[model samples]
Every structure is written in C-alpha cells, then in structure tokens.
Target: MACMKLGSKSDAFQRQGQAWFCATGLPSDIIVEVGDMSFHLHKFPLLSRSGVMERLIAEASEEGDEKSCINLPDIPGGPKTFEFVAKFCYGVKLELTASNVVYLRCAAEHLEMTEEHGEGNLISQTETFLNQVVLRNWKDSLRALQTCDDILTYADELQITKRCIESLAMKASTDPNLFGWPITEHGGPMQSPGGSVLWNGISTGARPKNSSIDWWYEDVSTLSFPLYKRLIAVMESRGIRQEVISGSLTSYARKYLPVLNRHQVVNDSSSRLEPVGLGAMVSEEEQRFLLEDIDRLLPMQKGLVPTKFLFGLLRTAMILRASSSCISNLERRIGMQLDQATVEDLLMPNFSYSMETLYNVDCVQRILEHFLAMDQITGGASPCSVDDGQLIGSPSLTPITMVAKLIDGYLAEVAPDVNLKLPKFQALAASVPDYSRPLDDGLYRAIDIYLKSHPWLGESEREQLCRLMDCQKLSLEACTHAAQNERLPLRVVVQVLFFEQLQLRTSIAGCFLVSDNLDGSRQLRSGVAGSSEGGWTTAVRENQVLKVGMDHMRMRVCELEKECLTMRQEIEKLGRVKGSSAWENVSKKLGLKMKSQMCSAQEGSVSKQKNGNGKNRHGKHKKTFTPDPEA
Candidate 1:
C-alpha cells in the first residue's frame, strides 16, 4: 500500500484508441509501440530520457529517415508498464507503489532509463523506492515480490525478488513482537504494522499467549507455490523452527491442494478439479505434483507434524495417484508417530483400482510394521515384559500400547467389509506385538466383527483368526461373550469356557481368602463401642454376597458340564461320520480331556464349599482337590 509520487505535474496524456498522445499541442515525432499499445509523443523527451530510444532515433536518422517507429514486443511488463515509463519520460504525473514498483523497475531497466540517460531518472528513482520503502515494510515487500512472477527473469536479474524474499524471511525468522509488525491468522491480519507497540512505548499485547507461533503462515500462504517454496528454503536456512515451517507448508497445501480440504478425490469418471478459488481449479496433474513437492518439503523430524495431517496426506496421495516414493515416505513418517493416531485417521479408504477391500488394509499393515520396527529400535516399551505381570489398561502404558488400541479399533471398523480377506485381516491384527496388547478384549471384538461379516470363512480360517487373541488375556465379559458366540470355532469356544472356569475358580479362592481375614477385621472393629452388632451385620452381608457368587459359579460349572457332554456327542458323531483313524483319535482326545477337566473343576468347587463349611465348624484347614494341570 506504500506509494511514491515521482512527478508533481498534472495529467498531460490522453488516449485515442490504442494510441496514447501527448496533449501539449505538439506534433508527434516518435511512435513507440509496446505490445498492442502505441505512444505518440515528441522525440526530444523520449530521446533525452531513454538510451534505447535515443539509439533507435539516431539509427533512423542515419538511414535517411527523420521519424522512427519503434516496436517493443518483448518488454518485461508489456504495454501497461511501458505506459508508466513513457509518462515518466514526458514528466507527466506518475506514482510508484509496491504493486507497480517492481514492474516499473524492470521496464526502466529494459529501456536503459538510468541516471546516465538523465539525472535522477526512472531506474534510480525506482531503485531508491525499492531499497528504502518496499524492502522496509513487510506487506509492501510481499506485494512487490508477487509482481515479479510476470517478469521473473528480469526480477531475478535485478535481484528484486531475492531481496523481497530475504526481507520477508528475516522478519519471519525473528519474533514479530520484536519488530511490532502485523501478524496474520486465518487469512486476516491481526494488527496494523507498529500496532503491537503503542506510541507511548507500552506494548498493546504481546501476541496473545494462546495464538499460534506460526501466525505468519496465512500471510505467506497467499504466495504462488514456486515463490512460497523459495521463501521456505530461505527461512529454513535462517534457522526457523521446523514446526513453524511445517505449519506454513500445511497452510500452503490447504490453499492449493483442493483434495486435502474436501477429503475426496477425482475418480475415473470425472477428471475435473474442485474450485480452489473463484472460477479457478488446479489441474489434477498440478495437484499431484504439488502433493509430492509438499511431502518432500516436510521436515524429517517426527512429532512436529500431527499424525492426523499425515494420514490426510496419504489419503490425498492415493487420490492424486502420487509417486510410490511419496506415498511410502508418508507411511514411514506416520508409523513413527503412530501412537498419536486415532482410529479415524487409520481408516483410509481404498482408492486403487487393483485393491478390493473397502479400506486400505495393506497400507495400514505396512505402517504398523514400520511402527513396530521403530518401536523396537527406540526401545519404546517399558522394562516390564508381557510376562512380567503387566496388564492392559495400565496407567503407564507405552506408545505401542496406544497404537495397539488404535489398530484394534481400526480393525473393528474395517471388519464389516466383506472384501477384506481372512489373510489380510489376520496379518494386520497379528502385526501388533503380544507385549503391546496385555489384554485381548479389543482384538477379540475386532475378530468377532470379522467373523460376523465373514461367515463364509472356513472353520480353519476362523480358528486361525481367533489365534490372534489369547483366551487368558480376555476379560470375563469377553470370555462370556465368546462362550455363547455361535460364530466362534468349536475349539475356541472350549478354550473360552476353560479359561472362564479357571477365572471363576480364582475368584472363589480370593473370596475364601477374604473370609479368612474377616474374623480379624471384625475383632479389630470390636474396640469401637456399639459397633459389634454393625460388624456382625457387615460380615453377614458379605457372606451372603459370597454365597451368591459361589452359587453362580456352581451353576456355571453345571452349564460347562452340559456343554462338555454336548461337545462329546458332537465329536462322537464326527468320528462315526468320518471313520478315519486320525479323526477318531483326535475326537477321543478332545472328549476325554474336556469331560475329565469339567468333572474335576466341578468337584473342586464342591470340595471348596465343603471345606469352608467344615472350617467354620472345626476351625481347621482341610486339603482341597486341585484340578490336573494338563486337563
């Protein structure tokens, strides 16, 4: 918005069609044509102020012609800029601004309008304004640089764009508060330049503590990508923080890459681009190149860019059909920060024609593999191994633990896709290390979902998918669900029942331990006056709860007995139908082991109850039956 007035004279130029005439009542002696526009004016002014024009006129005089018609078809700024140069030469009124200054400078250089042509000529005046005015102000420098795109080669030769970029980069690399320049956010400027510091030297507000440190992102995002790329390189060389640089890249991508914002891509039926600006749409090829370039510009540091943003990039990459290297690079980066990802982030839709699944399961598998590799290399897990009494939902869970949960949720989401093959689902589910999942509830749910959607899977395939979940690690609720789940393989059902029985037995044993301590706890309470009755009532209430729990366990044991009998019958039927020796042998093993284990587990519960009654009467410990470990 900064302006420099070069002349005090009123307007003396008038346009007649494509020809601009000097209205000084003088006959036109020179016809200078720049592009489609012609300038008709006195030769003295043009010859004295422009070295090129002087030479052209002298050459015409040498050729025995008094008049010269010069054509400048390749002028840097074309006709619009030449008009300003012509006015400057005629001493007509002319104004220089950040937007027009660079064009004028390039046009002046093209005409050789230096001080040698005349003192304080167009070139020197534009140079002084650029160095003193345009370069000193932030917005002015940006505006000036933006004008260079039309005449890039000329601007480069004059170093006008380089100077503007350097100025912006220097200011961006430093704190805005230090210079009190305007800051921008969400496509709007937050304050006027020098607004941060009041006239009295009191600071207005030091960039509200919560505002982003990269407030300049929006300001720089308006630039054309090539200029933006150069500015970023300069900023990086100046040591701007990587996160801030990342923010700027994100902003730039959001503006230019339409797919990133819409979260949708052009399909084969429609190659048209979404409108990024008013009536402007970037071509699919351009967006593809932009995506790859942005990926390349991203800093290599992990955790600086949000994982969700990375996932978005991968999604957009698939849509744009970007290079394989770009896609793989994004996947590796996502894996490094996989812990920060959400289930929604991992649910990338399948975009490749060759893929059949509803989601990009294989891509997620690769990412999980990379995450495991990084986790192993970094030693991200705690010292406690999975066997060292670590449980799921621990407060001190590691990064892989969170990633495990995230993947489980993702699997559950993708399981409903019938196109998802057993091998792909199983591979993705099994990619998470055992140590990562201390509990199999999440994995169990995912497997269940897969089983429900894929009822046509062979029994062996169902069993293989179930193998990814450890029955012992499943919580009681999951075990209960698995016990009655008809979708599960018979062998898996048996395992679920066996673990549920063991877990119930352990619960009963804990109840007995609590009962053993009950007397001491009651005696401890006996010292409080009027609390003896209350203590007995509390004990009675606890005993009732224990009795109810035991009854439920006994009922569960009977149900297991029935289930065991039914399973044995099925096995016998299978053996009779198959008539294979190996089949019979396996069926016999299953029936015998399952029947004996069910019987022993039942007797153990009975003996425990009897021993409890006897201890209450005799005040003595009794030996109780222990089930066979093999059974």
Candidate 2:
C-alpha cells in the first residue's frame, strides 16, 4: 500500500498541503499506513490496485477493529517511492530517471501495477524506460544495479538483472579502454592523490549502520555471487584485467575483499562464454573486437590478465575454429596483426592452474601453449622453456619463479584438497630452477597464506618450510616470534639480524663471560682445552666483549695509582716548604710522652694533660678538709 495525495471523488476534497496525509482536509473511510507515512483514501481504489491491500482490508473487517487503518510493515521502499507507485496506479504519468528507475520498477512490481489490461500500463512503460533510458548509459546501468538494495530480489523477480548486465556489457565493450571508464581518461584515471575519492569519508572499522554500502568498493558487497562473477567476467571480456578491476575496487575494502551474501534463489547460469549468459559465439565483427581486446593485453604483465578473460578468450578461440588450428600459425597471425605491441601477454604461471584462480580457468595451460607456440613460430626455444618434466622455467626474475616455489610448498604442505591440486603443483615445482632463492615479500606472503589454510601441520614441517624464508625480510613480529621459539638455536635467531658488531665480538672473544653450560664453555674457547669446574668460566660469545672492556679498566687503574702517588709527594713537599716539620717532630715527641704517661696511669698513677695555655700538665684534686676551708 502507498500513500499518495488522494483527491475527492468522495464526499470531501483534498489538496496537496504541508500536513500529515491523515491530518489533511479530506473525509476518508480508510487510512493505510506504510512506515511513517499514512495515506487517507477510499478503500475502493486500493482494492482495485493492490490485492495485498484488499487482503489487509478483509482481515481488518473480520477482526472488526475499530481503527479502519491497514499497516504494511517491512515494505520495500520509503514514503517517496511509495507515493510514485501510488500515483502511477492512479493513472498518473511517472517521470523516470536513472536515480529512481530501479526503485520505482521494484515498487511497481511489488504493487502488481505492471499487470496490463491491453493498453500501455505502468509495467509496460517501465520496460520501455529500462530499454530506452537505463540500458543506453553505462553509468546509469551500473548505478541501478549497485545502488538498488533489493535489486537482486526485485530484479530477479522481474527477471531484469541478466538483461541489465547484457546491456551494460555491450556498452562497456564498445568503449575505449573498457575497464577504466568514468574513472579513466586519455591521460590517467579518476582518483584522489592518495587513492580513490570514495576512500575519503569511510575508512577501515568505521561505516554508517543501517545504511547499505554504496561506495564502488562496497557496492559489490550487495551483489549476488553469480551477478558478481558476471560483472567481473564481462569486464574482463572487454580486455580489462581482473587485477586492475579488483585493485580499483579494493581501495575501500583495503584489507580484504568484501563478502557478498547472495540470494538463495539466484539463478545458476553456467553454460555461457560471456557473463550474464551471452551466447557462446559472438558475431564476426564482435570477434574481431574481442581479438583486438586480447591484442591490447599483450605487452603487459601476463599475471594482470584475469583467468576469466583467458577463459572467455579460449572460448572465443574455440568458437572461431582457431583452437584446432596450428597454434604456431596463430602466433604468426598475432605477430603480423600487432607488430608494434608484440610481446608475450600470456605465459605459464609458475604454480598450478586451480591454485592461481578460484575456478579452474586453465590460465596456466593456455599461457604455456601460447609461449610454446611463440617459441615454435620464432623457430627458437623461448627464454622460458618446458623440459621433459612438463615444467615451465625461465632464467629471468619473472613472477613465475616465485610462483614455482610457492607451488612446491603448497603441494607438499596442503593435504586435504591435494588430490584435485597435486599434479599441477608438482609440475610447477619441477619447473622451478634448482638454484632459485625464494626471498621476496610476495613469496613469504604466499607461504603464509598456504600455511594458514592448513592448521594441523606438524611443527617440524612448518619450521623446515619457514627456514627457506629470507629472515632479513621477515616482519618485526615474525622475528620476535622466531626468537622466542625453543626449537631454534639462540645463536641462529640472533645471527639472522645480521648485526656485524655482534658477530665480530663473538668471533674473537669466545668465552669471556661466565658460562651457563660449563662443559660447552671449554669446547667453545680456543686454546683452552682444560675445563675448570666452578671457576671463572664464561661462554665463548661473551669472552671477546668482556676481555676488551676488562683490559681497558686495568690500564685505567694503573694510571689512577700513579696520579695518587704524585699528589702525596706534592703534599709532603708543601709541608717541608712551610717549616711544619719542626712542629711535627715536637708533636711526635709529646705524643710519645703522653703514651708513656697513659701506660703509667693504667698502673694506678695520675696522668698529666696539656692545655693550650701550657701552664700545668696536670690538674690538682682537693681533699675534703681543704675543700671546706676554701669554700
């Protein structure tokens, strides 16, 4: 049910006013409420337009409710869209635009306003609107597809998603530089200095609640899986690599890809070359365009090409009757056709096909054949070649070298899905050069992804694989973790830091510090075969560091002793210059006399004491009679 500005054919008349619909000056029998909006109108028109409304009215009457209002909870659109649908049902001409077309179409479909009674009705008009207006512009079509929250349910119900995708695809393929349209220009792409402009308002861990994701990055989050696959497939067919597309979209979803929850009833359309189930074989002109699109990808990184496009290219090749033709001739044709841009765009990945892609796109196989064919066409083995092992290897430091190492580990480590994944991985590993040192950030990341997928791996096996990693490039956290592990030798972990100072000192002073392990200290120290139990034993590493420091301290001690002796001699010479030696001799004699008197006092004799006045050496004691006379 929708709330529109219902006018009189009733006992009262209403005009468009700034009050609530129910509060407006209209005498109405029934009030229909949809969300916060209410439509005060006669029940007759609603019954005629919507069976849903008719059923609600019938239920209300049976319940004999005093309120003659029917409330539609959980309806699709807001009040504005409902108003548009209401007016359309009342025979009002609807003005459709890209902004409101998707929502309006769904609203019409929900209200059953599209069921025509011969003449052109709202539904027929909507169909015409879609074909004539929405389908014509790539921006409008994608906007409708992504902006419409219920597009999957509504578009699926109306069976328009596939049609919309098809139309969008046609428009996209016709454009130059098909993938970067709207964003890309003759010089560059439309992006902020930092990244895409969409990254401005939203960031990681922050998004508005209750609002559907609307940015280009999050736009795909609302699409069904099949629709998402179709979108990617179609774009790739136009010569847009998945890497470019995914990289652009990944700006908002920076850490990872947004998970899109698809509708359960989404149709499964598998047997098609193009996305949206476009027929397998395109027209000859279209094929030329497709071939031209494939031609554009040459001279670029082969890894940049999405497997889906490879599949589409292969499918097109098969349909063009080129798959069965001599691949060498095809290579010659490619060279002849694109002399200026001739380079190997397609080449075998170092890893297995399935591991490289979500679907079994045989991207690796096709690239290998292309490379091989190019080699044969040129009449010489390519820089990369296939050996007797069916393994592909190249001397250049291409991305495949790293992928080969990854495949080797992935095959040996992962066990559950290995049956479906083994042969390809084995071949990839075999292709890797024996002397190839896997020591890049990407290689480590690939290894991490593989190990994370298999949680039950034994510790020793994990350690062995990880040992191959370049410790210098390891992250700070990884270094800390490796240092803490009991299995790894402390020396090895410390050595991985590659500190020249630590190695230099440890190499020289083998056992300067006290050793935690006694027997090992003797073995560790050079020229010290005899072990001293519970003595000044030190580890081999700490020896050099301590010896240097301790030797400097001993030399410093000798210098300090010489300085103290010189200061003492200077003090004695100053005393002699002042003639204080005579006072010293007198004081020494007086001290000896005092000491003899103290010895006599211990034998019950009185000892004399000297004062500053030098009058008496002893003080007299008064007898009892003498003290009385003196008082």
Candidate 3:
C-alpha cells in the first residue's frame, strides 16, 4: 500500500474516552463534536485549515452563544475519519494510505479543507497522493475504490470514486506483464509483487512466464458492484475485447453468486476465491439484481462465451428468481452456440413449483427452438446438395448434426422421467430437422427409451412417436434391436424388418460387385497364374469379415421370409372372416414377401456356388451365375 506522511511533529493529542484534548496546556477555545466523539482544541489551527469550521465558529459567536461547540452530524466518515482530520489540524503525526486515502479525501471535502484555507490543505494533499501513489498501483487503486463505498456521496462529489474506477479500468485493460506486475492464470499460484510464487504463502521459487488476460479479475472482483459496473463500462468504452470482459464477468459472478459454484456446469476455470455464502456477503435480493445486471452486461456476440458458463448462469438465474427477460436472454445465447453444449449441460433440474418432470424438458425444447431459429436466419444451407442431378452430403451440416446428436442424447436422459408428457417428448424429438440427422440410431435409442418408460402409450401413440425415426437411417445394430423389440408397435417392427432386409440386400449386391471386379482382374492376369492366384487369395482374405456378415444377413433375411409367410397365412385366415379388408391390409403392411423371396433365391445360389465348383477345361474357376445389372 502507498503511504504519505503528512505531519512531521510527534503526537500532541490525548484521547480520554471519546473526547480528544490537545496537550499544549492552553484552555480549549473550540469544540468540534463529530458523532459520539468530541475534539477539544485551540481555535487557531482549526480556523486556519477548515473553511466550514471557521464559518461555524463565527456563526456561533454571532448568535450570542458563549459555547464554542460545533456539531458535525453529517460529516463523511464520521468520528473515526474526523479524528485524523483533527490530528492533521493540530500538526500531530498522521499517515495517509490507500486504505484511508479515499476516506480522508471525502472527509476533507465535507469539511471544505481546500487550498483557499491554507497553502497546502488536506484536500490538495490527499488528491496529490492519490494521483501520484494510490492510482498508479493496481492493488492500491482497487483498495481506494473499495473504501469509497462508505462515503459514496462525498466521494462522488469529489470525483474520488470516478478517478479510482478509471484508474483501475486503465490498469485492467493493459497487460499486467507489460509493466512488470505479477500475473497469474486462473487456479494457478498467485504471484506476490515481490516475484515470489505464492500458494497460501509458501514460496515455490518459480515465477510465471506468460500472463493471462484474467490477471486483473481477482483484483477488480473485490470492488463494490456499483464501482465494478462503472469500471466495466469504462473498459468497454475504451475498446477492450469482449472475451476479456466476459472472463471478468464470469469471474465476478463466480465470486459473488454462490449458486454458480454449486451448479453442475463445469466452469472453464476453477474459482480462485472461495464460494461466498448467500445472505452472508449479499442478500438474496441483491444477488438477484447482480445476476440480472451481469446478464445485461454480457457481450451480445456468439462463441465469445462458453456454452457451459451460460448454462451455469441460467441455473443460477432460476435459483435467484431472476427476471424473465434475463432468463430468456440466457436461453437465446445458449441456443446460438448450442452445438457446443453437452447433454450434462442441458440437464437442469426442474426448479418450478409445478415440478412436472425430473428435468426441465420444456426449457430445453425452447432452447432447441432458438437454435433452429438461428440456423434458419443464417440461411443454414442444407447438408445435402445436388451434384450431377444426385444429392450428396456436404460438410456444412456439421453444427446442426452435432446439435441433433446432442438433443438425442438429452432426450434419452430425460426419457426415464414419467412426468415428461408424450407430446413434449415427441415435440423435442421432432425439433431437429430431418436433414440434420443422417443416421437415426441416436434418435431411435431415445424413442426406444421413451417407449420403455411409457408402457401405457397405446399402439397408435407409440406408432406416432416411432414415425419420428426413418427406418432406412437405422444402423444394422439398431435395426436388430428394433426387430426384436416387442415394446415397439407391430407395424413399426414390420417396417424395421423390411428396411433391415433391404439394407442386407444392398450389402449382398455390394459384395457381388466386388466379386465381379475380382473375377475380371483374375481373367486379365490369367497368364501370370501364380500372381493371379496370390492376388485372388489376398482379396478373399481381406473380405472375410464381409463374407461373414453376408452369411449372418442371409440367415436373418431367411428368418424374416418365414415370418412374412406366417404373417401372410394369418392374414389369409383373417380375410376369410373379415372379408377383403384383411387382404388389402396385408398388401399394404406386409410388403416384405417379394423382397424376402429375392433374398431367399440369392442365398440359395450362394449355397450352390459354395457346394459345386464350375471349372473350365483349363481348370481355372469360373463364375456360374450372372449378376443382374439392376441389382
């Protein structure tokens, strides 16, 4: 701390209880009563340096009052600071520091101790020390600003608060390392000004090399909210980066808002300070206002703040009972960069009194809507584009795809909540555009979870929820799960079977294409018999997994074929009783028979191919069946 000694003389005042009497052995000519304390002194020193005191003394004399007492009921800093002022007037030794400079300045201003009363009055002396010593140092400036809260009106009138805030802002905006100030990253050891690395006062003898922009966050976080607000405005007006401002805001919130420390969202940096207990440091109402103010001050740009931090703010907002607008603003911001959020970030527990679900499903739905709105406004180009009259996938869909996956995972997490209504579940599932999901595996899992938790959903309701998934997009594993899942509507299981069969056929056709290519290669290199045989053997070795998969798929298709046959037989029996409607329903719902027969024939031919070898006269193996070009 910076200190300025004002008086050269030894202490010449004695305090007997609340009354301080000068020790010059002269009868007291004047008494200045400040709150509970009284200063008894001669008139010469008080009259020379204090304009207000001189006028009060003259006014008392003019009123024909013999008493020489003057009461300073509204004196800034009250009796404690008045004691310093009294000592200065009497030329007793007095030391002024950053901690007390603001108090002395405000008190001096209140007493009208200006240069007009003396050559170098208390006001001018404090101002010079503040400008030259206190404001020039980072910690000193913060300390001075913190002291202004007790005498806000006087400090504002004298511009001490403004000067201190501006000084702190200037220092905060500059790189602390540029001027040899000790700098520390979040959660790292704080370095003392003496260049010693300190963690609870243990020296590690290691100095940090690079400085972070958050070096001033801890220092400035100690200021009162009003002063901090002014400092932030000044920094913003001076063109400080938004990211820096955001970091400071996050730091301040972490220190002052206790809920953030308790929330599940992982902060980018661990708070360097301990969690402040609610009602201990700030009242609940004050915390609420602080959160709203911080929300208002956040940068409007996207990607500048972390999504997790936004979630933390939102959770805290709900706990603090912040204004509706503040909560909405947080949701919009979260939506703007929602692709960066994880499932855990969106798992905010229901805080409403209604308590409809385990998690706030409706809030997440709104956030998803905001994300979609932003995507639409930015002309979210579709991931698929036409090339040569055929649509192809593009990388432009990365963000929406990520969000889709994130939402699917979130849905699965909330699916177990029985209180989550069916419509709400369906709405959230359908929020992401169809184009965004190239694969429905994640969506299927979530839907399946919802179905498992909600067994009471009727067949029609289950089908309606299942419609959100495109069967063609299901991975083989999901297809297998869906095929055996009795909880799914029978119609959905049929669709899953049909798509699974179709996907298997496509795989078999691909294998046929590769076999044809290999055969062509073998024919072309027949003259090099050893090389040809070696290459053929290597190709077969590489495709062993594909052949195994084909075998499993062929068996699955055959089982589906038998299932279709059984279903057809049952439909025929129903048609005899229910007229032609059952036949028509079979035609519409069980369209898998023809494809199943095709798979059967293909499997038969493959079996025949393995059992019998078709060798030419030259003893070279020959392909027995011709591939259908359409296949």
Candidate with the larger TM-score of 1 and 3: 1
Deviation (Å) of 597 in candidate 3: 11
Overall lDDT per candidate, in order of appearance: 0.75, 0.43, 0.76
lDDT per residue, candidate 1, 421-447, as tens digits? 888888888888777787889999999
Give the per-residue lDDT of model 3 (tens digit) for 333-444: 9999998999999999999999989999888988999989998888774656433223357555678888989999999999999999999999899888887877889999
lDDT for 198 in candidate 1 is 28
TM-score of each: 0.82, 0.34, 0.81
- Steric overlap count per candidate: 0, 7, 0
Q: Which stretches of candidate 3 lie over 4 Å from their true place?
A: 63-67, 176-210, 263-282, 385-392, 527-566, 572-631
Candidate 2 per-residue lDDT over residues 526-570, each given as its tens digit = 346554553343443344444344343334333333433333344
Locate the minimum summed-lDDT window of 10 residues in model 1: 613-622
Worst 10 residues of 3 by lDDT: 613-622
Between candidates 2 and 3, the one scoring higher on lDDT is 3
Ranking by lDDT: 3, 1, 2
